[model samples]
Structure formats: structure tokens, C-alpha cells
Target: PAGRFGAKTGGRAGSKPGRPGAAPGARSGGQGGRPKPPGAKAFGRERFGQDLGPVRAPKPKRAGRPADEIDVHNPEGVRLQKIMALAGVASRRVCEEMILDGRVEVDGNIVTELGVRVDPEQVAIHVDGIRLQLNEHLKYYVFNKPRGVVSTMEDPEGRRCISDFLKNKDKSERLFHVGRLDAETEGLLLLTNDGELTNRLTHPSYEVPKTYLVQVRGPMAQGVGAQMKEGIELEDGLAQVDSFKLVDSTPGHILVEVVLHSGRNRVVRRLFDAVGHPVERLVRTQVGPIRIGDQRQGSIRVLGRQEVGHLLASVGL
Candidate 1:
């Protein structure tokens, strides 16, 4: 290892001892000619102008829009839970539970408190990490169906359906009937896309009330209302009216008002027919707080906010 770095091997014949650059062996293997293979030396701070330290991965791009990008200053808004309920995510009470469980979010921030208010028109909302589409223009309509028109949006046989009346409405929201009525029955049918409200109105657990006006024929049976209230056995199951009354009567026809919570198909007609009377005409008069009022046949109108409010209140939504 004596001349490992091309140090002079003492003065050679006619050689400049201190100047290894002048040696042929040094030119071939030492610093005089061939480079030290560049990075053969250990790295040092002087290698570069500045200390970059250790390389790191780039900061991850933010997951979503930043909080500052959201308008926290929205002045007019409704309770966050109520907004979720209206969005059909859940009932307001259940939405509160979801919030408390950190499953609800507004503008990317998990909101656990029930008191948070949100301008749904301005803010983004989410539930269980999925973005929620808040229908700012929530729609509720009551259609006064006419006889011979189906209660559905379409019929394969070209029979007139409820869409005939709603197709020309100003709004374009897709609507569904809360429950079905046969082609011969009509009136006070609800059309809405409010899923939570619809569920409560139609679900058996809620027992939301429904009222019907029926025209029947045949001799009046004694204590018919009382007998019907006690329940009658039908092909599907037992059916009964919550309340029934004879509104008016002629020699051969009688008008009766019946209220019940069952959503059984054709239950009213079957109930009356079982008691010696057959229904000639049927019209739904009310569903919960909604009524046909004087709404003309084949007409439709958006429900008022107060009416919607009353309906939600009745169902604890």
C-alpha cells in the first residue's frame, strides 16, 4: 500500500520525484490522467451547494375541497338533520343519531352535533362517506285522479295513466304515487319523490291514516258501520276501517266515508261487498294531512309548505 494514491516511489532515474503527474505509470492509474471514477469518494456536504436532507414523498393532494373553500358564512339555512331527512337519507331523529355517530358530514367535515345548520343550496353534504344529493327543490303534489285513468305513470295497454295530467307540469321532477288506486277508483292521490315522507306515509309501522268516499248500492244493512269497524275477513287477510259513517243515502244508493290505515289492495271495495253492498264508485279523500279539497278531477297542484310540514310532523320526521 506504499504508493496507493500515486505517491512518488522516491526519485526514479531522471524523474521529478515530487511531481507524479510527470510519471507515465501515474498518468495511467492516478489523479494525473484517469479520473478517480467520480463518486469513488464518500459523499460530503461540499458535493452540492445546499443540503436537501432526505427525499420524501410529495404531500398527498388533499382528499377533497378544503374547508376554506366552503362558504361557512351562509346566513340562511335549515337544521342539518332536517335537511338529511328531506333528502330522504333518514328521519330527522335518525339523522341526528347518524350525526352523533360521526356518519354525517357537511362540506367534508364530520358533524356530530344536531344544531348545525346548512344552506343545502350552497354546501355539500355526505352520509357514510357518500355524497348526498339534496334536492333543493323538494316537490310534493296531490293529484285528483279521474275514473278510468290508472294510478301509475304508464300502462302497457295504452289506457290513460296519471302521467297524462302531470306531463305538462312546470317542474320535471320524477314522481311516484304513495299507493295505488284501481282504474275505477280516483281522487287525492299523492305524487312525490320524497322517499322518507313517502315511506312513513305508506309503511305499516307508521299507520298513517287514509280517508275514502264510497258510493254503494243495495239495501242498508243494520249497524253496518259498527260491523265493519270490528273487522272483516278477506281473501288476503282481515280488513277493517278505523272509522266509517253514512254521509248520505237515497232510495237505492248510499254515500259512505271510511277511514283506515291499511294499504291492502281493493280492501275497501272487498269490505263493502262482503257486507251485502257493492261499491259503485270510490274516491280517496285524504292521506294523513293531505286532502283533495275542491281540487278538480284530473288536476294536480304542488303541496304547500305548511301542508308538508304538517305531514312530516304527523310522522315524527
Candidate 2:
């Protein structure tokens, strides 16, 4: 193989003088030196629009942070218990129990952690294998409860109750009375399935005032309004009217408007009873910013958006 080109080509195999087939400096087909490291050729393959074999295995996931720790800066979702309650599944406390009991599912997987957040708008939720209908389209109504109607949905005593009125009304979603008026009392009562609004309205810290129009036996006492305004200590606690105004007056009966913020059972009747003017007829005229507004007795109507908004705003909801 020692030839004229071999001396000038040096020791390298491809450094020989050029010629057909076996040129001294020319290499054919075979690449020189060592091969590339595995998968290194795939680099820039995507840039050239070539198939670089199956894409390189995904980069290994980083490991450092604890799994149990939640990132407060970026929350995953709404709390499972809260969203369930909002969906009218149950009360918040009951929802928590349902979750702990392993009767709740998210995205077809059973989720028992109460802390787990779920995107209610995106995820499918179920309870006890039954799909839950989210109360996304919340409903708020003003029902003018008539006399002899119990405030509750059902009574073991088999008395007439709010369910009777709701029987003919809309049944799209479960609705609850925000507050109660006894069977003998009647007027504007709020009915809604909006858990947040209901919570804020019913919470004691909000001090949402309720107004009542009462027909009571009067004309004997002159300073009755002042006495009721001060306060009347009941067995449970101090019950007081925020303001008292006389709407009409007669010897036999007088119509007065009483405003109070207490939610104690039958507090209104107790207040009038303490004042020595027994209430002949008690009708709740308003709660917060909502009023009966001449809605005939036993008639139910959906509240206007503005009315609902104002009612919520009054309680800082």
C-alpha cells in the first residue's frame, strides 16, 4: 500500500491524494473517528423538520417540595365541601361529613379530603353515586306566606306548611327559607338556594334587620314605642326593636311597623306580648331591603336582580 500518495497523505487514512475508488486522501461512505453519544443526533432534528425517532424521554420531574403542602399563591380550586353545599347537596357541615364518609366523587374518582379544591365549573361532582346538579343558576324568590302556613317544609304534626305553597311553584332546585315566620304570621319570606347569600343573610354578625307590620290592641299606652325601642329582655336574650312607627290607630286595634334584627324564635310576638299590647295580626313586611310590596298573600315570585343585589349589599355579602 506504500505509494507516491502515501508519504504526502501522512498517517491518517482519509488524508491520501484524491482518486476514484481508492484515492489516497479521499474517504468513501464511512464516517471518521468515534460515533456520537446516544440520542445526541436528535438535537436540532425538530428544527430541520425531520423525525428524530421517538421523542427523547420527558425530563425527570423535579423532587424537593413536600406533597402535602399546598401552594397558597396558586390555589387549585374551590373547596369540595363549600362547592358541594353550593350545589345544594347539603349544609356545609353535612357536606364535610359526606366527604369524610367517602360518599363524594370528583371526576369519577372518590375524594375524601375536605381540603381538596375542585373547579366546580369544570369538574363533574357526585354524591353517593348520584350526579349533583350544581346550583350555578341560583334562584331567589319572595313568597308572600299566608296565615296558617308553617314556615318549614314538613311537619310531623301534619300541619299546613311551606311545602304546600311550593308544590305548585318551580321545582328546578331545592329552595330554603332564609328565615322563619310561624304558622300564625305571614308576609314576605325569602326563598333561595344560594348558599352564600343565605349564609350572609342568616348569620347573626350581619345584623340584617326584619320589618313587621303588626295589628295590635292599642290606645291604652302612649310611651309604648319608647319602651319597645329601649329593649325587652326575653328568656333567651335581650330582644329590641330598632325603630317603631305607628301606621294607623284605632281604639280596638292599631297598625304599627316594627323593625328588629333578632332571629330568636317568635321574637316579634314575644316583643309585642311583653309591651302589654298583644299582637292581633303579625305580618312581616320586609327583610333587609326586600319588602312584601303588595304581593298578594300566598303568591310567589322571583326577585328582581336589582332587588337581590341590594339585599345582598345591605348585609355586606
Candidate 3:
């Protein structure tokens, strides 16, 4: 008789004792019965009866900030991208791309991750290897100073000066000229509220270069350029041009360009005068990286971001 132990008396060899006609040690809720626990080491069988290896708990999701996120250096300060955009590096979106591309550096470290925060006044930021000016209050400009205008912001004699052209500016800004161009000299001049940069630029140690276009009585002597390059004895000290080139030559006037690192007063006029070709008309064309290209006379233009960066770099700022 078949009992609850599955026909123990007449069960076939190796048959389990679960139920009548049970085959080969089969149990009610064993391998072919209930679903296995997720952590079970038991092999699973696919619908097609293919053997599937032990089920593994889905790899615990990695715990931490994602790769794209950066640790905020200054939680309360402005975002790096925002500051970069304000500093005129580019549009906000473009600045983000630049940061991700690793073209930006904060305090000398290449910053690739986004969401970085910094105090514009505290940290030194650079883009494309050029120092960025982050101070919104510090203004820089290139004024196309016309002839007979004194370089002083205000002249005591009441002559036309830089201040006349700056009447439209905010009175509280307190901007000052970086260096100076004499009353008779005309062309590019830098005006800024950045005192440290101004001092370094004007200092003799930095040797910030200045370029000028000089119109002199023509038929210049053969060795004038060479002699100027060699050195010219000025009332103050020896002065020399870093570069000199004859641009145009006519019957009575010769147009020449000279570049020098001397910031001495009236140095260009004195150099040509010493060489026997007194400057008939003098126009300063460049100061460091800033240029007066096509800028109309007596007009003021804000210095571009790249120009300011280059100017800062020229004096090792």
C-alpha cells in the first residue's frame, strides 16, 4: 500500500518518498517547485532549459558624487563658469565647455570638473594660459588721445585734457592714466583704475614696450635706425629703441615706426631729435599688447578681455 512516505514498501530504487509515483528523490517545494531567493546560489533554468549561473545582487550602485560634479571650493561664492562669463571669457555655455575641456586654471591647477566655486577677488583664474581680470570695479580703456591734449585727467591751466573726454564717465570711478603721452603727442593711451598694473607698467624694471609712428623730415640718414638701436644719450640717461623700421618715405616727410621699452617723458621726440631728424608729428600706436587700430581721435573704447590679459601678462602680473 502506498503510504504518506510514497509507497515505501514497493517504491522503485532511488525514488523519493513524497507521493505516489514520485520519481528520483523529488520533493514538493524543491528545485522544480517554488521560486529561488534572489541571493540563492542555486542555478536557474531558462525557459529553453539552458543553465543560468547563480543570480547576483545588482552591483550596489557606486556611492559618491558623479564624475561630472566637482567639490565646491567656496560654497557661498560665485560659480566658476559664471565668473568666467562675467570676466568676458565667453558665453556661459561656451565657458562650461572650455572648463570641461581643461582650458581653465584656478590658482595654477587645471580645473576640469564643473560646479566649482571661487571668490573672484581671492583666487587667480586663467583661461587659455592668459590671466583673467575678474574685478568688475577695475576699468581699463584705450583712449585715442588727439594732439594738444594733456595726458593729465585734469590740467590746472584749464587746457583740454583726458578729463574732458571722460565727462560721460561715472564721477566716482576715479580712473587714472596708466602712463602718459605728452600734450603734442597723439595716439593710443591706457587709462585704468588698476594702480598695481599701472605702477608695474610705468616702472623701469618691467620694460613694458611702447610703439609709436613718427613723421620726420625725409631723406633720413642711412644709419639713423641703427644708431637709435645702438643707444641715444638723453638728458635723463641712455635710451634705445627695441625696434625701428621705416614705413613710408616721401619728398619732405618720412613715416617711421619705433618700439621702445623706455617710459621716460618725451623719449621718442628726444630720440629722433638726437638723431638729427626731429619728429614733425608723433603718434603712439601701441602700448604692450593694446593697439590704437582704426580708433578715431579723441574717442574712448573699453579694453577687450584678451587685450587686458595680454597687457597684464606683458608686465608679469
Best by lDDT: 3
Candidate 3, TM-score vs. the true structure?
0.75
| Ranking, lDDT, top scorer first | 3, 1, 2
Query: What's the lDDT for candidate 1?
Result: 0.75
Which runs in model 3 stand beyond 4 Å of their true positions? 1-72
Superposed on all Cα atoms, model 1 deviates from the true structure by an RMSD in Å of 24.0
Question: Compared with the true structure, what per-residue lDDT tens digits does model 1 show for residues 60-140?
Answer: 532444333444424367888888888677788888778778797677677766656678877767677555655556678
Give candidate 2 misplaced runs (Cα > 4 Å).
Answer: 1-136, 167-169
Which residue pairs collide in model 2, if any? 15-25, 16-24, 16-25, 17-25
Stronger candidate by TM-score (1 vs 2)? 1
lDDT per residue (tens digit) for residues 1-317 in model 2: 33343333233333444345553322333322233356554222222322234446675543433313533211567888897777666799999888778798777777666567766767767676555545457788899999999888778999887777775445546888898888899898899988888888888999999999999876758888888899888888787899999999886889999899888889989988887878789999899889899799998888764575477567654
Please give, for residues 1-317, the per-residue lDDT of candidate 3 as tens digits: 23433433434323444566655534432444544566765343322133455567774532444433544367767889999988778899999889888899888878876667888898888888899988888899899999999988778899999888885654467888888888899999898899999899989899888899999998887998899999978889899999999999999999999999988889899988898888899999999888899999999999888898988888877
**What lDDT is reached at residue 23 by model 2?**
34
Worst 10 residues of 1 by lDDT: 42-51
lDDT scores for all predictions? 0.75, 0.74, 0.81
